[model samples]
Target: SKITDLEQREKAQYDEITSLKAQRDSMFLDNQASQEKDRDFLKQKISDLETRCKAAESEKSSLKFEIEKEKAKLNYERDHLESIKSEMQETINKLMKKNEQLIA
Candidate 1:
């Protein structure tokens, strides 16, 4: 009777150990799945950030181009106005010389 009780106790202990090992394995798998989800989430975020950065860079380039074009237009207008002023001055000088000759 003593031997039989000892054998039963050993069997129960072995069963308990197996149960605990199964629970540990389940927890480990759950942890691995959680880590995988986090990794995927981070990867998606990085991709989104990269896309935004590209868009910002493109916009900056476009704005710079527009600024340069506007500057060129302003320069052209300034030069055109200067040329008109020079022509008007020459006409005035010619008219003054003619008037002086007539008076003399």
Candidate 2:
């Protein structure tokens, strides 16, 4: 009777150990799945950010080109105005000299 009781107790303990192991393995698998989902989410976020960064860079380059073109146009207009002003001044000086000769 004593040996039989000891055998039954050993079987119960063995079953308990097996149940505990199954629970541990299930928890580990759940944790691994959660980590995989997190990694995927982070990768997608990084891709989106990279796309936005590229678009921003392209816009910046385009705006810079437009600004440079405008600056060139402004410089050309200023130079043309200066040339016209010089021509007008020369005409005025010649007219004044002619008037002085006629008066004398």
Candidate 3:
């Protein structure tokens, strides 16, 4: 009778262990699912960052092109102003020469 009672206790302990193992497995599976979700979230964030970087690079290129065009326009204006100043100097010299001839 004692042997039967001991056997019954052992069977109960074994059933309890099995139940605990199942609970542990369930918790492990839940942790894996949460990790997968985090990984997917990180991947999406990385993709978004890459897209933003490309857009910024494109914008920088466009800004550089605009700056070059503005620089060219400024250079052209400076050259045009220099040419007009030279022509005015030549006209003043000619007028001075005429005045000197009249004085003589």
Candidate 4:
């Protein structure tokens, strides 16, 4: 009777150990799957951010080029106006000199 009791106890403990091992394996699998999902989500987020960054860079370059073109046009117009002003000043000097000669 003592031997039989010892064998029963041993069997019960073995069964409990097996059950605990199964539960541990199942939890491990669930954790692994959750980690995989998180990894996939992070990767997609990174890709989206990269695409947005490229588009922003392209827009910035285009805007810079347009600003440079506008600056060049303004400079050309300024130079042309300065030349016209100089010619007008010379013409006024000629008119005043002739008027002074007639008065003298």
Which lDDT values do the candidates have, in the order given? 0.98, 0.98, 1.00, 0.98
lDDT value, candidate 2, whole model: 0.98
Put down candidate 4 lDDT per residue, 1-104, tens digits, no spaces: 99999999999999999999999999999999999999999999999999999999999999999999999999999999999999999999999999999999
What TM-score would you give candidate 1 relative to the actual structure?
0.80
Highest TM-score against the true fold, candidate: 3
lDDT of 1 by residue, 1-104 (tens): 99999999999999999999999999999999999999999999999999999999999999999999999999999999999999999999999999999999
Q: Name the candidate, 1 or 2, with the larger TM-score value.
A: 2
Q: Tell me the tens digit of each residue's lDDT in model 3 across 1-104.
A: 99999999999999999999999999999999999999999999999999999999999999999999999999999999999999999999999999999999
Give, for candidate 1, the lowest lDDT window spanning 10 residues: 87-96
Candidate 4 clashes: the total is 0
Superposed model 2: Cα runs more than 4 Å off: none
Residues 26-89, candidate 2: write the lDDT tens digits.
9999999999999999999999999999999999999999999999999999999999999999
Better of 3 and 4 by TM-score: 3
Cα-lDDT of candidate 4: 0.98
TM-score of each: 0.80, 0.84, 0.89, 0.84
Candidate 1 vs candidate 3: the lDDT winner is 3
* lDDT of the structure predicted as candidate 3: 1.00
